[model samples]
Target: MELSPRGVNMKRAFIVPAIMVLFFSGCGKDKNEGGKTSPPQAKSESAAKSGGEKAQMPSRLQQAVKEGRISEEQARQIMARRAGGGDKPLVRLGTAARGEIRTHLVLNGTVEPERSVDVYARLSAYVQEVVREEGNRVREKDILARLDDTEIRISHQQAKIQLEQARLTLEEEKNNHQRNQELKENELISDMDFQASEARYRQSRLEFENKTENFKNLELQLNYTRIRAPVSGFVTQRLIEVGDRVTANQHVYTVEDFSPLLIRVFVPAADINKLQAGMNAEISSDTLPGRTFTGHIKLINPRIDVQSGTVKVTIEVNDSSLTLKPGMFVEVNIVTRSREDALVIPRTAVLYQRDQVLVFRFREGKAVAAPVSVGVTEDDRVEIVEGLEEGDTIIIQGAEMLKDGVEVSVLK
Candidate 1:
């Protein structure tokens, strides 16, 4: 083609523009990343609308969208929300229940021996009596069983006779000495003879004293033929049968002291001040299902546990009806302090976090953190001393997955 240089250049440039236009045309397209989603759908809708993401948006952005316009920060908030943002950072919640606030302690404890004594027979005798069987109830001085008193009584009688004989012999010696002294004064007997009589009489008196002691001891032994309960309680062990012979200090039966049964509990050192002697407790256990036993604090250990950081608290329960036995694993609820009109919330509403306590309250439709001073937490309710007003809306279910100021779908 016949061409001028300038016109040729112009034609080349026009062709290049046409090619560039064709090449760049697809670059601005709203591609379906997959036909299921629109890359521009989210962005384009956001340009004209408040907060364009259909799924989620932050509280500030949601507000702006309601007002028909949003700031750049609001738009950023929408993007962040779309990427899984929520109000109230990951926390836990429980019910904010209204009730009395009572200080309590959670402890691990064990049952112990309450002055258990293995009965021993102090006198040697054949068990001639069977008064109490195993697990039988006995009282102090109550005869548990008896031993053969025939031998004991005979020994006692013999000792008593000997004691009387010794006393009579000593008396006769004294009478003779008195008369002999009178004879010596009259020079009717030699001095050596008088002295000899007196010596003999003194020796007999000493022997008599020894015999008297032996007699009393023997009599006491005779009384031991009747086995008596040292203290009142149910009999646990009975080693002797009806005819079994028992020697001195031999095991016969076992008795337990159960005037008021003792219960031991451990409490945290931080809450030790709340615990006191004579505090009321409610005891329960899996073994004794559906049964709650009431008890009172009998002792509070003066020392704190260094290793476990707990204090030992003891409660005494009345098991006189024989229903509660020793060594049963139980749950003891110790009431240290209580308030009839204390501000309390749900224990679940307050997150039991490590090192501190946290609560998430819905403030003006946004979740905000509320640091709390936790008091008595009984069952599902807890005492909130700080950081919340009465009747505040606290998130119970969704607090664990929320961030501050994020949009929340309240559960009504």
Candidate 2:
């Protein structure tokens, strides 16, 4: 039956007062009975004791238990759940999908250029001008530095003059020889005189040839006084400055060709058979972070080093931008094997137990440690040969603490 607001308020006030009086009287009776009391009194005593215990509880929890909203055990369970969170373990998941995967044999090597040449002075002279310094790009026969060629130039000019004089004398001897031949043919001059003229002509010819060669040599020497690049590349080192004396065949500069950089690596003999020319490779440098370059195997030595038991492999990188420099430390990953449509998953998700390989497969909010046949294990990724299909979700991170059938909460 519905009651008016005024009647409801008046009834609540009377009931509250009666409840307080009954509680007080029950408490007083419990105190008076002391060790002995009737069944009803004993029940009142028990109620009073339980009420005191309930007062120590939180207000909301006391109200809930008193109103029969929740049992004591259920309340404790809720508080424990709130205190320690839920019992489900948190995990990161990844899907098994078909993708390209490759296995690499990693090796460390030093970056080298296609060619490196040491520019040397072909003639002894002092450096007169430094046209190109270190880090200067140059081409074949480009003048790098001009040596002091003043003395060589003067000598060359003198040789030229001598060569011209010799040529004139040779012409004169040739005419005399022709005249002598005619005279001998006509019997106008004696044989001895003709023979002597012929001899002189021959001597003049020899002298002319010798002078010609001497002039050519001087010209070559003059050209050598100018240091030039032997190949087209960058000047990586300059050992001479202006006014510095350099001897013939002395190293003056070092030039390197940066196009199609090369790297030589030594692989153990056991793995050498896996390598071949024209295989793809990945190149990276510690100095240039986050940058990757593509390359291919240029050469592979068939013979293995007896002492080191390793084979030398050459990697060629076509880095047109020249981002990688010679002598920089680099790492090379030779892709010896690959697959186009393989079941791939994170390598971290795989667990190795004894002779079996397992992965935590997430299904129905539970982790199932299932054994899988693993194929190629590459960097951070592994190829599953069997036991897992496409679109299957597996625990990637936080799988180390997982057991069979353990519930988990997948993190987004």
Candidate 3:
């Protein structure tokens, strides 16, 4: 301990090499003790074989948790996701209910009044008074607007005076002709003078008839100053106002009958045979949601359009509440066929594969595909004619990746 610095360094080096050699020798002795390998080495080989056998299973999930590769909760989740546990396709189910179903053709068209009349002015005159404005309800012959009748009335009065004067002159001529005839028959005057008097009386009679017709013409012209509604409906348009001059046959107002509206839809020629003049139709509008108006086929055009290959069909709507109006674009569903008390299901539940129609029926928490024969299809519903019964639960969603006997979790 008290040696020089060089002597102390040499002694420490010799003791460090001897200690390392003894440590290595002891490790070798433990590895081959009693002609057997160490316990840790044997355990590692056994684990490798066991891991290969259960690699695809969750048997090693707990070992992964112990090794800090995963959490304890994650290990439980992995085990739970195996077969005979919570692993299943999530799906929504719908019941096949017995109800009315129909086959229809959908089309879009503009709403028009059953009877839309354009009120026209018969005489050219300046509008004097506006009796009814737009949106005013009117009946047949209701005055919509009044025109200036000053000139017409004055002419009417003058014609009346002329008619009266002609009537007086005609009466005098008749008396004179009678007197002249008596004289001519009795030979109390010359033949030429009597003939001349007869001519004068005939001319006066002709003048009176002309004046009577002229007076009636003027009276009719005076009545034409008032523009009247031609039909009973709501006034939809007012083209004339106070001091607006309107001519003969000029459009002044538009009256539309909303009690029963009209919708003209052009249907394809292929579907023309299925339609008739009295088929039931359901009408709906985007502007008015959740409301359905009823109607029927009023007429179907016999001629088909050569260019478009579509036939024109007119629908007459029965809207007692006046909820529908003219010019509203609406969707029309013309029912071609219907079935009552038929088993129907959501259309999305059906799967079309080749020529067969299939649906996934939920039974015993599994998806079972069944072939179905469908009939009339209306909107999002289809009639189940075969292979399904009422009150059966079928998969409505999340069945795209499902196979036969595959487990499912039905959603509420």
Candidate 4:
């Protein structure tokens, strides 16, 4: 029913239809804009092409990548970076800031590769030829030696002849069996004759299989005539030479990677925990005094040296000088603990009164005698590890005159 327009109830029917039409039309728009509304993210573009779910990044990130402002990998790296608790970063104060407490173990160490192998013989024969000597550089799969292959060659030839003979015999037996069957069907040959021919054919097939297997065995044996280096390295030892008779599974040479020699230093159980794989290390040897080789911890042994109460921490060094030799004694320095924006003051600012620790904090351009907490100590600085903050000037050159409310000026 229709009512007068002046009444509020008169417009109800028109408002209801208008809202319903708009809602249904919006639904259609959303449904039709699936792929257009959600463009794939950089990482997911390839995935999307392979029929995977599409991902969308904010328009800013997409634009940044498209406009060459940032690479896709850089964007991914930024996204992967931890928020660091979304807290303010601490800036360094002086050239010598945060006392990087280095828990260095200046003890004995050795050098070796994280990966090494020993050359071993896999077949039994005399060393017919040797191409590489000790301390010589060898490439992987290079022929190190060759065994006396005469026996193997002879065996291979014998196998080939036997196989050929077996083939001919099998063929002859097949023809004999076929002929016997034809003759018996025509009543010219007895059943006994046909059975004998079938038996011969079966026997020949068995002999052929045996010869084929022997031939394959001989082929495999022939392949073992030459001994090749399993890996590229410097041969450290040579155990066999030409005319030397060696058995299978014998160690013939010891090779090692010397490009970046690996050295291991036994770290105390207590100190080992301070280091991890890939931690930077500075190593030195008495053989190379005043020279420090930079490297990183390659491995840390799980088992502790029970006798020494230490664990063997392996180190790989890029000491291109060939200075850090395996079995050479070495001293190591490893950075263990570090902190950012740590409060620090001059070492001379603190006085150790026997068992007590004291420091003079500056306030209002004057010194205020303040007892302070301390941490790691370095060559010229002591970490306040507790007290000061950014821009808190301290007396570096004069600390003995520092006292409560004593006015002072920062040195220019």
Candidate 5:
């Protein structure tokens, strides 16, 4: 308790320094704790803000729904998987099934009548009467037109008169020759007279034959004045009219048979080998929408066109309705290859990377890349020859965004 001034001063200084040091140390600890705690609070606020933004932003499925491109049910299913917030990727799946696949060779073609005939005038004369006009249905031997037969009729009559006269002369010569033969046998006629009589009979018989031939020729010419249909068909064109002067062998009418229509197509040389006579084909035209005509290959040209690098093919269509007309442009689809009971998958599931053909198959909720051998492709399905089995599920849509072993949530 009794101390000197120097000692009091020294004690005071030590106590003040210790108190200040304790105060500063407490403040530093409080600052450090606040720093540590405030950061977590700030991080929590930032995380909450980020989550709110993500919820407000539209997902791929939501966007599709807004665009009217997808149904609400489909969009809902897609969004449901995304809302789960997992590592799984959303994908559309299709099942590999047994089906039929057919490959076709498509080409442009033209329609024509199966049978066409050009009727011609057989006699040189004026057209006296036209019984049938264009678009008239005619049968075989049906008279389509008639020619003026005045000159031909007169010639025929003259031939008949000459033939009758020759017949009478032949008969008289035969009777004379018979009497002469009797006289000669009784030694009442000379040998010269008998020879003359025989010569007269032979000449008369030859004359008769010549006249008969002339009469037949004239009769044929007279028949030719009447124009007849060579075939049973509809008259497509008529170039002759009543009182029109026509010459022999001139085209008078054009007749066509349209019961079975013909379609001609030029096929590329590369696909010609796949075609044959009697192969089934489907034909369609833009002019006649929603109509499909069934036909079969009728002919195949053995020679290939060097300039166009194509081969001519003829197809016959049964057009009983007569809806198809000649010169109509049409499209033809010929089945080149076909397979039944084939393991098939959607064409969209196939992926081409470099030289490999791969498909993303679903196995245990993961996408597994499988290399597949492809065969005939028909419509939206492709024949899987290898690396896939029936009933296996494969990714159809959203396959391009997937890789092997990635988790996938399949949408029905």
Candidate 6:
């Protein structure tokens, strides 16, 4: 414990050198084990050892370091910031370009037949035969049903007898009037009797005309006993059966023309001006999956619906195959406006935050939040009216998790 000053200096010098040697030796070991190997190199070595494959740079920092844009220490610090939730989230990217953007007005509607008619009985009769049933296709003037015509036949026969009897009486009266006229010219009969004969002839002629008209009406009733289709179509409803006594004007069948099915949609009044007759339309149904039907605007109602504030639009779709049925619900898409070569981006890329709409645009390896004014939207694309130019890449798929000035990796 009792040492001189020289002895103290000698002990201090030896201890300092020894400590410096130990520190250098530990630094050499650290360089060999971890410090000299970069994160990408270490990842590659680990990947090769585990699966014998090249490792991929997982972050923007590692990629920057590998590309010599940033030092290893900087990359480590960047990754630390990212892990601590101080950096922006990773997102998938897309490019803004010039493309077509269409504006569509979507409306819900019901499918119906383009033309429909209800067949009714023209005369009271008993249904004796049913020739057509529901879902049966028929042509114009095709017999659909038969009614009992026995009473009509009897009435027709009676009318014919009366007509014949009146004709005979008319002939007899004419002959008598002619004979009376001849006698009156020769003064063989009085002028009064001649006038009486002339009056009887006229009355008989009128009776004959009345009888003939009655006979013709009876004939028409006989024809009506056979109910016929007024137009070519499918029978949607059949109300008559055998032995059913139907009165005149009673509904017997309902025929619907399905060659071109009609879709009735109510569009908002604001969009009514853009719609016109013969505009192309697309229709889809929940009942039919993955199938879209093409159609055109058939008619646009001039009157607006007072209750709904919408205009009635009729679209006609070809259904020659009879795949679409009446009363089926469908979705209709009407193209209101379309622009070619408009600046556009994926609709999913547009983000609405508060009152401002923005998109995360990728520029210089970072996500740059840019405000955008949108116009028309078609399908999965939207028209960018302002704040973006062509060839600019924007984050689309993972933009919801991204913020401004975040490092991004473009996925191939």
Best by TM-score: 5
Please give, for residues 66-93, the per-residue lDDT of candidate 4 as tens digits.
Answer: 8664567655443333222322211111
- List per-prediction Cα lDDT, in the order shown: 0.75, 0.87, 0.86, 0.71, 0.88, 0.86
Give the poorly placed runs of model 5, Cα more than 4 Å off.
1-90, 409-412
TM-score of each: 0.63, 0.73, 0.73, 0.58, 0.75, 0.71
Q: What is the lDDT of residue 235 in candidate 1?
A: 87
User: How big is the RMSD of model 5?
Assistant: 13.7
Tens digits of per-residue lDDT, candidate 5, 5-42, equal 99999999999999999999767642345474345667
Minimum summed lDDT over a 10-residue window in model 3 is located at 76-85
lDDT of 1 by residue, 1-412 (tens): 7999999999998899898898898565555657444556686666646544454665755665565443456465546544555542332233454567776665545555466877889877788878998788788889998889887788888998999899999999999999999999999999999999999899999999999999888788877888888988878888888878789989898888776777787888888887767778888777778988788888888999889998888888876575677777788877767888777876546676687778888766677777888776677677887777777778764465566566565542
Backbone atom clashes (below 3 Å) for every candidate: 12, 0, 0, 4, 0, 0
As a whole number from 0 to 100, the lDDT of residue 207 in candidate 1 is 91
By TM-score, highest first, what's the ranking?
5, 2, 3, 6, 1, 4
The local lDDT score (0 to 100) that residue 378 gets in candidate 4 is 56
Off by over 4 Å in 3: 1-85, 88-97, 360-369, 389-399, 405-412
- Quote the lDDT for 5 in model 4: 67
Task: Give lDDT: candidate 1, residue 276.
Answer: 67
Give the Å error, residue 5, model 5.
66
Off by over 4 Å in 6: 1-89, 301-307, 353-357, 369-371, 400-405
**How accurate locally is residue 282 in candidate 5, as Cα lDDT from 0 to 100?**
96
- Checking candidate 5 for backbone clashes, the offending pairs are none
Question: Per-residue lDDT for 1-412 in model 6, tens only?
Answer: 8999999999999999999999987765424455573456776666655652233435754655575644665554445445456644545577889977889899899999878999999988899999999999999999999999999999999999999999999999999998998899899999888888999999999999999999999999999999999999999999977999999999999998898999988888998999989999999999998988999999999999899899888999996677778999999988889999899998879998999999988888888899999999887789999999899878875576677887876543
lDDT of 5: 0.88
